[model samples]
Target: MRSTNFCLSTEGADVILATSSDEKYPPENIIDGQSETFWTTTGMFPQEFVICFHKCVIISKLTIQCYLVQTLRIEKSMSKDPVDFEHCIEKDLEYKEGELQTEEFSFPEFQATHLRFIILSAFDTFVSVHRVIAEGIAQDI
Candidate 1:
C-alpha cells in the first residue's frame, strides 16, 4: 500500500486539544505539513495534543519533527471519541543543536481513529513541535 501523510489538517485530521499554546503557535501547526511553522509549549512539561482522523486508518509508521523535546509518548484509540486510549510508543529523543529533532517510529499494523502525542519532558523549559506525519492507509468501516 502507498504511504500517505494522514496528519495533514487539510486531509481532515484535527487537533482537538493542546495543553499549551502561544498566540502565534497553535497545535494545528503540527499537522500542517510545514517544518517552519510549529506549535510551542507555553507552560510546564507534560504537554499534549490530540489528532483525530476523519476515519479509521491502519497506521504503519509515524514521523515527528520538533525542537528541544526530550521524552515523547504516543497513544491511540479506535473509539469515535478521544477516549479509552492505549499506549503505542514512547521514546527519549536526542538533542540536536541548530537543527530540529527528527524521529521515526515504526509500529505493527494497527487501526485507530485518534492519536494522542504527549511531551512528558523536554530538553528546555519551552518546546516546539514542528510536524507529525502519520503514514497509513484509510480503512473503510
Candidate 2:
C-alpha cells in the first residue's frame, strides 16, 4: 500500500467517506451505491449547490492508467429535475513526481440538492481521496 503522501482539503463543510475497508456500501449520507455517494457541505442546502473536485494524489500513479469523468448530475430537493455537469470542467491532467495528476474540477453553476462523486474505475494502488467541497445556495437558483 502506498503511504498517504498528499493532503485533502475543501472550502465547504466537507465530509470524508473512506471506502478502503468496507465490504458493502456506506450509509445513505455518505454513499448510495458502489463508487457513488451524496455529498453536502452546509448540511442544510435547500435546492441547489456548487461542488468542486479539489485534488487527488496518485501514490503509484501507475495504478490509474486513465482518469475520466463518467457522469455528472445535478439534483434539486424540491424539484425532480436532474442536470448533468460532467463536462463542466473539461477533464485535464497535471504533472507531479512523474505522474499525470488531475487538475481541480470546479463547477461555477453546479445546481444540486446534494453532490456526489462517481468513481468509474479503480486504480492499481490503494488510493486515498480528499474531501469534495460543495456549497449550497438560494440566490443562485
Best by TM-score: 1
Each prediction's RMSD to truth: 0.8, 13.4
Error of 1 at 116 (Å): 0.6
Please provide, for model 2 over 1-141, each residue's C-alpha lDDT reduced to its tens digit, 9 standing for 90 to 100.
423312113222222332333334222223211223333222221212232223322222111121222222322222222234332222323334434233344344333332334342323222222223232233222
Which model scores highest in lDDT?
1
Q: Relative to the unseen true structure, what is the C-alpha lDDT of residue 24 in candidate 1, on a scale of 0 to 100?
A: 98
Candidate 1 — which residues are off by over 4 angstroms? none
Local accuracy by lDDT, each model: 0.93, 0.28
Clashing pairs in 2: 49-112
lDDT (C-alpha) at residue 123 in model 1: 87
Every model's TM-score: 0.97, 0.32
